[model samples]
Target: MPSLGLKGADLMCAAPTSLTLVMTDMRLSFPSDEELLSAIRGHHIGDQPLCGFAREFGILHEQLLETAAAHAEIARRRDELAVEVDTWVAARLPVPHPNASLHTETVGRLLDRIAEAQVHAYRLLMTISPDDPRVHAAWYRLAELVDGYTDLTREVIQRARRLPALGDRR
Candidate 1:
């Protein structure tokens, strides 16, 4: 309900004067901080108290926006620095064989395939009635497949662990 000394375009460019804007009239200036604080401290619900609170809240809002921008810039700089360090470290390290990650790739692909098969099996099982004899057989089949997959995964992990490290001829 009070003017904030800001016009149409100036509204976006000017420093915040109050927490709200209702009309574009002349800016309603407040008294000095000391006087405003004294009035606010007295806890009176008048013009000075309202103005004091609005001024402080507007300033806090601006400060919070600035703090958020600063944090985002810091995060961006940290990410850039991390990339630079990674690049430097990578350049200093020995390159591995092209197929160094083959096992991992294979494992990832197999896992994806297994997940797809399991989803299909589940859908099929859902189509059959719970009381059907075939439903019980399907459940047993799913259990067996899951057990086999778990055992296979364990064996693969064990074999991988026993393999020689990269660049080691022995």
Candidate 2:
């Protein structure tokens, strides 16, 4: 319950370095774009030759690969941050914190952040060209994920409100 209490807030706060913090280190430096691409290539693509489809799009492959790497890196970092936040929340929030409004307020703040991130992602997606298959593909994937996050955040907020409504927890 403490995790649900804070996991979304932290994830909502720093899901990516873009979402917020750079858990890679306190130096605030992120891996270079080239480094991220290389890491992805080594793990997944692994000497896979680009087909004629990629050749047709030229630079599209580069952008798509970078975007994919960024996406995966963000997801990875979010999980890392969640573990850290969970540990802190477990200590502070406990089984029944002195105030349930804390849960409600934290979750409410998280909901707002999730909504903002989703809206920002959607606005950027709209600015992209529909005719461009490469970008649209990435946009579609991102839009789907953000929408899901928005839904999940809403659900968490609703559940958190229940603790307060139950009487003593509040």
Candidate 3:
């Protein structure tokens, strides 16, 4: 059976040291970003002892927070863009023989714009510090929006295909 590698032979094979040695080594390793922030913010480590490191880490953390906020703003703008495109699509799609060429061209342009916006957002999100939970959540939301927009564009393509003269002209 597959093991969790936390006990007995698995643990021994992974690290041929006693559990106490493993625990001691783990404790000596540098703390994670969250742990560092908690230590500095909570004063778990004496201020005088870690003042320089804390200040530097604080600045980096603040920068990451600002980046996360910017990502959120970009996401909001993308949402607005999506709404605008949806409105334009709705207005034009209902008209009979609404310049099929123009309609298809507009839809393609909108999809391209959405794709570019998503790419920019993803790049910005990737620059954010990985340890920040907000970054992960924002990336996930952006991914969902990208997926939804893609699905919507596929539906638009289907609608365009159903146009009696569209495939014939193409």
Measured against the true structure, the TM-scores of the candidates, in listed sequence, are 0.27, 0.27, 0.27
Worst 10 residues of 1 by lDDT: 161-170
Q: How well does candidate 2 match the true structure in TM-score terms?
A: 0.27
Residue 22's lDDT within candidate 1 is: 23
After superposition, candidate 3 runs with Cα above 4 Å error = 1-87, 94-128, 160-170
C-alpha lDDT of residue 61 in model 1:
31
lDDT of each: 0.35, 0.31, 0.36
Cα error of candidate 1 at position 58, Å: 51
Candidate 2 stretches with Cα past 4 Å from truth are: 1-79, 86-130, 160-170
Q: How far is 118's C-alpha from truth in model 1 (Å)?
A: 2.4
Clashes of each: 0, 0, 0
- Residues 36-131, candidate 2, lDDT per residue (tens digit)? 222222222111121111111222223333575565654443344334333332232223323333334232223223333333344455776656
**Candidate 1 ranges with C-alpha deviation above 4 Å:** 1-109, 160-170
Per-residue lDDT of model 1, residues 1-170, tens digit only: 23434334322212233222122542223223233222222222145323323333333333433565665554443333334322322232333334433232222222223333344444456787777776676656645644543444343333321212333211
